[model samples]
Target chain A: MELEELKNLWTELSDELEKQKNLTDKIIMNMTQQRYTNKFEKITRYESVGAVICFLVAIGILWKFEELDTWYLKLCGGITLAFLLIMPVLVLRAIHQIKKLNILELNYRDTIVAFEKARNHLLMIQQFGIYLSFVLFFTTIPVASKLLSNKDFFIMEKEFSLYVLIGVVMVFLYFFARWGYRSYKKITNSAENILNELDNGV
Target chain B: MTKEQKFTELIKDNEGVIFKITTVYTNNESDQKDLYQDIVYQLWKSFDSFRNESKISTWMYRVALNTAISHLRSRKKQPGGSGIDKIVQRATENEDQEFEDRLKILYAQIQKLNVLEKGLMLLLLEGKKYQEIAEITGLTESNVGTRISRIKQKLKSRILKS
Candidate 1:
């Protein structure tokens, strides 16, 4: 077909397109408004688990070191425990805010956006785990020496081993956070590229 | 208006942008609709980052083409059938209709072109200049001009044969 002929056809099609614009626009608007629930759920689950672990660890620390009577240890333990208890609740609230309501289903684009947001949230949560690990590892030293002084060799050795274990876990969590961040970046970039293609009319 | 409301208005105004692109790229109504929705969803997700440096339509075009190309690539990975097969099946269904007969044939022929060739022809058919097509498709301006001339001749001969 000649260029002019093609242009004429496109002109006719464009007219038809204009008629559907309102309907199409509504669909787009609705789809864009819906959030991806599955990603939000996953984030919530991870955060909840992190909270539970931190809480249990805090309880154990408080019970084991109760005899030491050190204000610094008590304060550190209380703060870590409080943060551990609160982090999951905060994450859950954020997840709820991003969830799609019962009135509508999430569209493809909204799902992508939701997933990106969830990924970022999870990455932040992972960072918190790193910070907690540092606190636990460093604070355990003075607390362990003071509290474990009167304890048996077996108990002291076990306490030292547990501190080492916490350090290893922190290192793992850091790498995991890095990996999650990279994956989120990759998916977002690919999604953006696809959007660009659609915009160009190719 | 709220940010979301403003965003919706923008989509409502420019939806034809997606519709026209999908119509040109897909041979069937269903696929066209799917591509259109995909494009819109992508645009909405990226709306927050949109600066006013370029025309909204220009930005929309860039996003839409990138989405379509990525969709094309991913669809290539599926088994049992390809997007081309889907297009051809739709085109063949229109064989009996007089008005659509020629357009169907054209679409079938267009589908036979490789990715780059199809991009060039689609832009040419849309009346984009060689320089504009070059900028969009990342081909040199001279190369775009040469390719469009070649594709036009090739398509004309193919349509003539039909």
Candidate 2:
């Protein structure tokens, strides 16, 4: 069929579809106003809940920081408390950037550009989250060791191999961080490729 | 009336556009219905932002195309085989075979095009001008012309071969 022929057929098809009128106006309107929350919106809500939990935990740790006997433990607690404070704001800001795309407000090209920027920002936040988690994991080691050292039973274990324990923890952290990075990259890359295809018209 | 009521009225008027678009982009009836709901949902989601800057039909075209494209992309990420064949077999067991055959052929040809090609072709099929197609698709007028010409040739060859 030629282009004109295909166009004619399309018109006929449209006419057929019009005659079908498969759905009621009420159903369409209901769906339209349905407040369809997508995956990203749900994820942001979960992140907000997590942010609250992080804030509470940070406050709890800071409250108990004075109880620590060692200077290093106090320092670790101080750094972790600072991280907990800063991390949520970073997370929230990334969420804000993603939310700001508001596809309904922008033109096609601008929407694609805005979505790309938001996804990239989100990818950066994911990377930062992974690295910060690794840093926190390492920092907690000494704090944990010191807290355990305070226990009389822990003090009795003079021949305990703290180096071996740290080595095992480090290995575990490495694999855990790698897995997190891979998952984030997979999601962001999928989104990024879609944007690229849109922008480049591939 | 209120905004919701007005928007509902507008959608009802342009309901043909929704069905045409959804049918063009999706292969099966179930996917078509899914895409139709998604387009309506997106239109309503973005309706408040629909300033009188453009014709309502134009704005609707843009939003519908955008939503359909995004929906297709997300579906690509996690594809599941459709049960549309069984559904069609059951629903149209006694329907007009001629109309069904023609539509099946038309949709088969359309599904051969890539996502961008499909969008451009759908707009062309709707009798949109190059400038209007460009406006909705974010392509330059000249680019739209070039792509449409190329797509036309590609479709011609495929149709002839078939």
Candidate 3:
């Protein structure tokens, strides 16, 4: 059939849908009222909320930093505050990149490119977050030992158990990073394939 | 009326666009409803920027097309995410068998199209001009003309083969 005939059929299908009694005002109202928040919107909201919370926590820690008496505690406090300060900026930048993706304005192809870039950027942020977490964990021990020594709870002596604890954390960090990268790869690879399909044409 | 009330009214007027786009993109009844709701959600998300710069139908087409395409791409990664399955059967419950058969053939032909071609064909079927199709699709007018001509030829040849 020609485009004209097909157009006729198309109109018929639309008219059929229009005439259906089930397509009532109530259904339409329900659909409109529904907060069908897509995944990206939810992610953006979570990131913004997380950034605010992180900012507040960092401020609180800096405000209370002087109370930490031991040298190692002060060093760890500086490190933690530095990390906390840096992380919100990165998160805010990411949120900005995501918000800038005007999918409604860009052509379909440009939209795909923009979305992929944003996804990759987010993956990098995720990797950075995991590494920072490992740093925080490792740094916590020195701070804890310092506090313990100050209290005479324990003395700093190099021990096999210390080596064992470090070994366990290192192993855990390695697996965590590996798992994170794999998850990141799975999503980005899927997005890449879709973009390739669009480029290659139908 | 408030901005949201106006949006709701505009949606009610152009709800068929959602139905049409969703039908072209998805084969399952459940997915069709999911895509319909999703398109409405997306249109609302971007409604503040509508600004009367384009006709209401034109704006609706752009939002619906983008939402439908992205929805399909993401649906591939996680199928069956929309849990509600049985809602749209009532809409199809009374379609005459003859009309149903014609729709079947039409959708079958559309299914054979690539994603981009499906969008073009859907726009063309809605009687959009090549200029507007170009604008909505981000293809040049000449590209829209050539591809649509080719699409027509392909559809004709498929009809002949069938």
Candidate 4:
């Protein structure tokens, strides 16, 4: 139970481990041949795909800039365009920060602290995206309807489609944001606990 | 030797460190295997950038330790679980039951430590010097000393009480 006794046990274990290798060279070689993924790879892919879609939509709006004949439509178009253009960069930048952690290169303290900061940045962006998405939701519906469907949502006699689009986005955003926030909070809390242990041990 | 060959060689030489580290960070057998592969993958991912600025062991420790801790953050920690016994059973399948039981007990005590404490204790138990521990963990030597002593006392009490 003593410290030295524990060390002795560890020594015995180490000696045994050295003699008995679980991972053979063949298995390790296969491991080297295999590709390993980071926990954030999925997020990176989603963000990247979202960015591309946003960029494409922004381009579509620009390609059909003449469709914005009225002042209000243009304003709505402008708002949607800006959000589409900016959100991806912010999201991708956050993803890039996480990718840049370079865990293999940094020491434990730096890696954890950097990881916490990156996660906080990401969480902030996600929360900001969620809240700001409502405004985008309202603007994008009209602009997208105008550009893609050639239907003026405001002037249309039948407003059922606009309401349906709004309902869908509202539902999707509500559930997705709620889930993303809860999960990210869990991950951040776990990282923060380790950071606390590092600063104040035992 | 080629880069992949060298990395493989180094990993082969230090396979036990990775095995032991993964075992400590994770409780379940599947997770341990996943973490072992993850650490090797990270090591190779960063292998090209190693540059020999520090000792290979120190560098490997940093990578393995960081990867293990990061990998654990995503999953829920299940302390005081029966998973360690499964790993012990497999690791010591050919050895005597008494040694396996003792190993299981040691791991159980370690599983109770906090993430940071676990890393510090693993380094200490591996016979790493204070300077090397400080280097791998990016903590000042004095701070490592303080934390290790406190963790040591804490572990001793927990073991004795149990």
Return the top candidate by TM-score.
4
lDDT string, candidate 4, A1-202, tens digits? 5678778888887787777666666777788678555557767888889899999989989999789778888999999888889988998898888777778767888877787778788888887888788888888767877888888878877668756876887999899888878977886787778777666743
Question: What docking grade does candidate 1 earn?
Answer: incorrect
For model 2, what is the alpha-carbon lDDT of residue A163? 64
- The list of candidate 2 runs beyond 4 A from truth reads A1-16, A144-202, B1-6, B19-38, B45-53, B66-122, B147-162
| Model 2 deviation from the true structure expressed as Cα RMSD, one decimal place | 5.5
Better of 1 and 2 by TM-score: 2
2 or 3, greater by TM-score:
2
lDDT of 3 by residue, A58-176 (tens): 77666666666667678786887777778767866875686567767776556656666776787788778888988877655655454434431134567798789889989989999
Q: Which one wins by lDDT: 2 or 3? A: 3
- Residues B37-156, candidate 4: write the lDDT tens digits: 888888878888888889989989999999886673345556564255544434433757777667777787787777777888999999999999999998989989998998888977
Tens digits of per-residue lDDT, candidate 1, A2-117, equal 65565566565556456543554456566666632333466568867876886786676667757656576666556655665676676666566544321112322333344445
Q: How high is the TM-score of chain A in model 4?
A: 0.77
Ranking by TM-score: 4, 2, 3, 1
**Preferred candidate (DockQ higher): 2 or 4:** 4
lDDT tens digits, residues B1-162, model 3?
977677767877776767777777775666676788887777777888888877777778887877776553343322322222321335435636666556666776776776677888999988889999888877788878988998999998977997
List ranges where model 3 is wrong by over 4 Å.
Answer: A1-16, A19-35, A52-76, A100-110, A144-172, A189-202, B1-13, B20-38, B41-55, B67-88, B91-130, B144-162
lDDT per residue (tens digit) for residues B1-162 in model 2: 998788888887778778777766665676677777878888888788888888887899888877665443233321222213321232344676665566566666676676667778888999989888888878788878887898888987986786
Which candidate, 1 or 2, has the higher lDDT?
2
Q: lDDT for every model?
A: 0.57, 0.70, 0.71, 0.80
TM-score of chain A of 3: 0.66
